[model samples]
Target: MATTNLNIRTDKTIKEQADQIYSELGLSMTAAINMFLRATIRTNGIPFSLTLNEPNQTTIEAIEEGRRIARDPNVKGYHSIDELKAALDV
Candidate 1:
């Protein structure tokens, strides 16, 4: 196989962050980029989801309420699923 060079310019901070993450994942930036490109060709697309699946306002409010409940020690927490079900009178 023959090889060639490809150069790209990216934000320095982003590149540094990506390099750190790739290093931790046992890949160099070059290897990571090649993997992404190969996957793109294999899948005939970006090879990952690019769409936003954000929750709506009501769902966001409910999620926030759940978080609040999770942080409250006064609210009871069951040690087991059965206990939770029993508390719910299931």
Candidate 2:
């Protein structure tokens, strides 16, 4: 089999973390990177979707409010699924 050298640049902190993880997994950094490259080539793209978007603040606030409401001790509990559905008018 033919072999080639590949060069990549990444954040120092991230690289250090990856090195530690790979070492613990019993793989050298070069072997781990080569495995990733081989998988990418086989799939013709990244193995999974990569996103950098932040969560919507309004949606997060709504979820937090719902959690607070759910945790209220005085909140009424439904006796059955049917009762809960009826209470919600659903």
**Steric clash pairs (candidate 2):** none
Q: What is the C-alpha lDDT of each candidate?
A: 0.97, 0.91
RMSD per model, one decimal = 9.3, 10.5
Which residues of candidate 1, in runs, are more than 4 Å off? 56-90
| lDDT tens readout by residue for model 2, 37-87 | 889999999977787776688988998998998899888988899999999
In terms of lDDT, the best-performing candidate is 1
At residue 83, give the lDDT of candidate 2.
100
lDDT of 1 by residue, 1-90 (tens): 899999999999999999999999999999999999999999999999887999889999999999999999999999999999999999
Q: Which candidate ranks first by TM-score, i.e. highest?
A: 1
Q: TM-score for model 2?
A: 0.57
